[model samples]
Target: MLQVFRKFFHSSVGVFAALGLIVMLAMAFAAGDVSNMMSSGSITGGDRVAKVGGNTIGTAQLTKQMQQAVEITRQQQPGVTMKSFLAEGGLDLVLDQMIDGEAQMAFGRKVGIVAGKRLIDSELAKIPAFQGAGGKFDQNAYLSVLAQRQMNDADVRDSFARDLVSRQLLAPAQFGAALPQSAVMQYAALLKEHRAGSAAMLPSSAFAPKGLPTQAEVSAWYNSHKAAYTVPERRVIRYARFDESVIKQSSVPSDAEVAARFKANAAQYGASETRKVSQVIVISESMAKDIAAAVAKGESLEAAAKAKGLSVASLGSVSKADLTIKSSAAVAEAAYAAKAGATAGPVKGALGWALVRVDAIDAKPARTLEQVKGEITAALTEEKRKQALAALTEKVNDDFGKGGALSDTAKELGLTMAETPLLVAKTPAGMGLPAELASILPAAFGMDHEGQPQISELVAGKSFVIFDVTKIIPAAPAPLDQISAQVMADIQLEKGSVAARAAAMKLLAAGKKGGDLAAEVAKLGVALPPVQQMNLGREEIMSRGGQIPPAVALFFGMAPGTTKLIPIAGNKGFMAVQLKAITPGAVAANDPLIGQVKGELNNLAAREQGESLRRAIRTEVKVERNESTIKTVTSTLAGGN
Candidate 1:
């Protein structure tokens, strides 16, 4: 238990260190933007968002923490935008985490859990982010990093102190969790248990109405689900692109240039001499001499090795430079001197003594310049184009800095300026953008209308683009007249699914009452698909065949011979499940699996206990929240204001 607590404490401290590094990097990157936003009065004027006991969580502190969290999330999900993060409740999650941390700190202070200045200083010294090139704590590097992030030394020390206090307060809950042997064994057995069951699918298409859906029915369905039919907001962008391929055709290398290139890189166009050799290494010089003598007597190396309880190794085709093994230079020299089928060597090696045999020799072949002219010309052309593109990129960047229009720049540079089709954040296929441009969809769509042009690399560094959004098309529902056919089809599918589910239920009920399921299905004029045997857990069963309906998971806990009706594929079909057999897994009391299960359960219990303790502390201590201030901060961080 003490070991567990020690491990947890170390891991928690490591996490705090990582978070601190992220905070520094994020603050540095977002300093200018955050300063501008704050100056614009985007955030409501308030010194603090919440007060927990005597500890006040200031708005500036919360905003800084939120920025760090956002940066970490961005690293994990490369293309995530602020809007998507807010929609996913990222702000709420960060707020809860901050509040919890403050609650823990407050409780620690009340209980006299103090982190001394000496401990805090020691931790700060050990952080790699604060270290210099020599891998030792450098006060200059530490101060420089803080200055870049607009943070001072006192702010960092305070943060470290709070982290230590929180860890100390939560140590008891994290370390006290333990599981009984019986519970561990039971959980392990449950995880190992496997059940084999069969299911028959009843597709909705089999029960689809022969008649078309009425106009009224289509309209009714459309009215109720208007949001589903709405097209998401999209953007039209105008951009100028430059790549290696865009370099002038006249820039092709001349024959003289190609010849010079080939001459300069002669080794690349010539094949080196290689030898096929076999060797037998032994622990002693006598053993090596005996093996060489055996080979000299026309005995095969393999046979000679077997007689000496050793193995012969084939070096395959290798050049002199490829012989990298210890003492291989002498081995190569001897092997190359020997004629094919000749045996040589009783030479000492790093491992032992060696006997070598030359199997075959391949001579070097030099390629004529004409034979590699095409490759050389292509390389030269690529180099010239890269240089030209770099110059063009620099000019375009200068123009952009001076507020020159992209279209005018494109015209001046003889580059094409084109508008992209209305593109969504995901940029679905058939939008007609080049494959390379597809990668920039997230950046393009995340921009506001008429926002500054962003430069992005495409095809690695070989290509570059400068683009700006030309128009924004807000999301709205399509008119009924435009998608009446699709709406009617959807309505018909829904009705068919309902009918299929009813038929499946009837079959299940009949089977439970000792009636034949297949016969009953046939009576409804529908033929059930053959039963498929599956051994799966709840999640696996639910995800089978693209998307399995939630109802099928009920069979996981059912006994053998139980019958159930389950919807399938999100209203695309229905299924009748008959539990065929259950196989009990044998779990030993002393099994390693039991220990693993116990460890997982203990970790979960510890996390839950920590959460509960935080909640209890929050309730005991008075907490005052400024709701309007939090709203303003949340909006500002989410880029809504």
Candidate 2:
């Protein structure tokens, strides 16, 4: 059901939809500007990859955008390798996007639609990653992020300018596009239609070859399909864990340190009193006295205030100092001076004359040094422990920077060294490893096995880990001898799949020629499972969690009395879909579904118009591609480990 709905929306809506230049730029800012792309060094001798009008996209720019694309993809698929990414036309897509963006901007300039520096600056300030703690653009953060991305100010500003210009040029084309009601009604009918059919699964296993293939056959198949047997790169990580507990000496605070801390924060340990008050302020002092007199005559403060068309404000529980700042020192003093259940405030406040009712009082007595000794000691110890842990981490990092080993540090610190089995980037099930290790698993996979040992804090200053890659198992085809059994099994399945498809096709032909499906299945003479009946509506198909079975979808797509063959997922078999009947659907005029379909089709129509505008703009600008440089970059990225 959604397939037909999605079909109308798949068309490229210019560079905005294809590249989503602005969205990608925001993502790059948030995702820490894609790391330097050409990690294996430049392959084009710094030549330009493309030229749009007078603007040239150099190798650095193309590769950087390509890397950004890959980084964005890896957010959803973490194990995506650069080689696989480039092979999947990631380089072409990014380069095309760059060319399109440049074309749009150049076309924009010709029409006097220029993105000014202020406009670019405004866009940059909107990115959260470029904002400071005050939620505004910060020069320091902007400069720091630029340095981290290995990009300069001019290049970053140019990127923003191009994106802003592209948006300005293409946005108007799709701004108010909508499909007519007649078209929407026709599309809405598909959702209410229903179909009935018969489906038969011709299992490959049911038609398997009699015997396994010989070793020679397995060798040829293995050689031809080596990628099927390729192993993902794996690593063994050796690590040592340490925490504040290891710094027993420095983490322990002395008595003098505790006493000094206590002395410095003496005000924190002083006696304090707070009062809960119901207060009301009047513009005139005499009015406050009247309210106070009424309260003193057995009327509640809240009732007296309500009679005067005023509301009593419950100041919760607040200290004298807090109340003084909130109201006035006189009001606070008067409230505290009165006993509980008494009305004593008819005093001047910053707002006006204040009348307060003392409802409750909470008093805390001052504690002697001995009473708080343990508490002070614990606090001092915690502070000292954090300081000591930070120092230890710094020392370890320094030692590692100087070529010291994790083993040496582990031995010196008396930490227990541990090692993981050869593992992929994803944590295997049941490993129960530290969550911190899971967080850094991708980084570990990216690290060079021969590089220096690295330290990571597992729990900030409290706990940390020092780890190094112990062994590297590079990805390659598994040895033929080791996987011979698997190869033979695959060969048999391939043979059986061929037979199943032929049988399914023959059945499909017979059904289409108006033969009975039941009779056709019986003619196979192999005692296959009976034909499965299907009576499903569009809503029923959609209710399968959006994963409609191939046969069911085929049945729905077919006309009444028509049949088609659909291959089962996972090479399991082929499905013979015989559409016996189709029930035509009638939609009423006032149905809500019609309105829903119209809204969706309107968005799709808008995108179509936008894409048309983009195509015209691209045609208007001259774009040249350096195929040789692109190919070279592709080869290098695709061949890298």
Q: lDDT scores for all predictions? A: 0.71, 0.75
TM-score: model 1 vs. ground truth: 0.58
Per-residue CA lDDT of candidate 2, range 1-641, in tens?
11221232234232122122332332322111112221322333457676666656667656656665676566558889788887677777676765676677668778999779899788667655567776899999778756655657776666566656666777788888988888888888877888887888788888888987987889899999999999888888888888877775756678888889889989888898888988888889777778878887999988888888888888999999899898889998998999987888789888788888888999999988889999998898788777888888999999999999888999899999878888887766437456567755766788876456988877766778888888889999989889998888888888889989888888978987898677898888665778898888886777788797666767777888877887878787887878888776678999999989988998999889978987788778866677887877777677742
Best by lDDT: 2
Residue 600 of model 2, lDDT score: 95
Segments of candidate 1 deviating more than 4 angstroms: 1-48, 58-60, 132-134, 211-431, 437-491, 508-523, 533-552, 557-565, 580-584, 624-641
How many clashing pairs does model 1 include?
0
Off by over 4 Å in 2: 1-190, 248-252, 278-297, 304-313, 324-357, 432-440, 543-545, 586-641
TM-score of each: 0.58, 0.66
Candidate 1 per-residue C-alpha lDDT over 200-287 given as tens digits, one digit per residue, 9 for 90 to 100: 7888877788899888888889999899799988888888787766555466778889988998998888877888888888998888
User: Candidate 2, 363: how far from true, in Å?
Assistant: 2.7
Residue 42 lDDT in model 1? 20
